[model samples]
Target: MHIPDGFLDAKTWITTTAAGAGAVAYSLRQAKLALEPKRVPLIALVGAFVFAAQMINFPIAGATSGHFLGGTMVSILFGPWIGALVMTAVLLVQAVVYQDGGITALGANVLCTGFIGCFVGYGSYMLGMKLFRGKGRAIVAWMSAWLSIVAASAGVAVLLAASGTFNLATALTAMVGWHMLIGIGEGMITMLVTGYLMERNAVMTGGGFKNERLSRNRA
Candidate 1:
């Protein structure tokens, strides 16, 4: 979800920029810890794939279009930190080279779609796995992805409301309403990609508590 320039007031943009900067910094450190040598090239490839996929926006209800967010897919394959990093790179490329998202609102976009999206999806997946004892991994992945998109849209709604662009109630209704529909597409793509990529053995191995290897294993 790209916030166009002028949608947010100066104060909102400044505050979000600071928050986004902090999130990016913390995520970078987490990425370093999560990184594996063999995964670097795959991470780059995922980044490229995300970048390409985002370009083809599918028509949604009304004239608006929605695209694959890719946060859950990346996080499932790598980790949340790497997913965030990859999303950041994708947003950067879209803003600078493709001019799809505005430059001034780049930080806000990253905050909503990159930071919040990645963490929410990945965190929910982990929590669901724990709660379900990893039995319905695919279902968990779908729900995680669906919820993440909705949450990210809520974040955007709050930010826009904070900017005084719209009342909180109205913004929440509009943003959440549209994104709920959009998130169906996100859930489908995330579930398919994650299911296709995850090893059958890895799915079974998730029951082992203290299995740090599962965390490190790339899909």
Candidate 2:
């Protein structure tokens, strides 16, 4: 859900911009510390994949479009900080080069789809893994991905409501409703991709990902 220009009021956009900027700044620091130099290529590959996935959107509510958000899967493979960076990069390219999303609303879009998506998705995945005692991994991944999409869509709805673009209830119903269906694809993709990556011992498997989990648990 890439919010377009003029959709959000100045106050709403400015507030979201500040919050989103702060999140990204923190993410950069955390990612630098957590990320391995060797995984840079993997990050680039995932970022490209996410950008391509977002490019193919299906119509939703006659107002917006829905697509697979790779945040959950990426976070599982690399961790939240790097996942956020990947999403931010994709959003920036789409906004500047393709004009797919508005520049003014970039911060808002990032807050909802990048920051919110990454953290919520990551958190949910971790929690699910914990709750299930590390069993039913595929199911956990699917549920986490689904929840992440719903949470991100809800964030977008709240921003729209604050902007007076639509009332809170209406915005929530419309955005979340359409997103629930889209989330199915999001869930399946996240489950299969994460499973494959882990099985193949790809990317952050033993290094960054394990460290990320350890740090998170200690926290």
Candidate 3:
């Protein structure tokens, strides 16, 4: 969900930019450690796939077209940090060349869709994996994506409230309500794509998958 430039005021834009910068910096450092040589190509391909998938949008409840956010899917396949980085890149390109999103509102979009979405989805998936002893992967995936979308919507709601675009109650109700419906779409896409694309042997590093290239790190 990319917020247009005029949607957020200057103060909200500045605040979100600072937060997005910090998150992107942290994610970059973590990505350097998490990604292995063999995994680089795969990660790039997955990012491209996510980018492409996002272009195909279906109509939602309020005449707004919702598409695959792909944050949860990426985070589950890779990790939160890498997933964040990938989304940031996607958003950057969309803003710069494609004009899908606004440059001034880029930071807000990144904070909501990139950082919030990736971390929430990945964190919940890891927790679910632990809770279920890794049995119900599909369920965990679905839930994680569902939660991530809602969380991102919440982030947007908070920002809108802060910007005085709407009162907290109204913004919260509108954003969360729309996203609850949107999240069903998100969950379905995340589960289906994750099941189809993420290979079992794909290395998961720097989040919860400790088995990933431990020897390489030592070396």
Q: Candidate 3 lDDT, tens digit per residue, 122-215? A: 8898789779976878889999999999999999999989999899999989888988888888899899888887554454455444554463
Lowest lDDT 10-mer window, candidate 1? 201-210
lDDT of each: 0.86, 0.85, 0.86
Candidate 2 residues 1-219, lDDT tens each? 789999999998888889889999999998988777788898899889888877777765567667888888888888889889898898889999999879889999888889888889999988888798678999999998998999999999999999987799999998889889889889988998888877532443344677756754322
What ranges in model 3 sit over 4 Å off? Answer: 199-219
Position 13, candidate 1: lDDT: 89
Window of ten residues with lowest summed lDDT in model 3: 210-219
Off by over 4 Å in 2: 58-65, 200-219
**TM-scores for every candidate against the unseen true structure:** 0.92, 0.88, 0.90
Q: Where does candidate 1 stray beyond 4 Å?
A: 202-209, 213-219
lDDT of 2 at 69: 80
What TM-score does candidate 1 get on C-alpha atoms? 0.92
Best by lDDT: 3
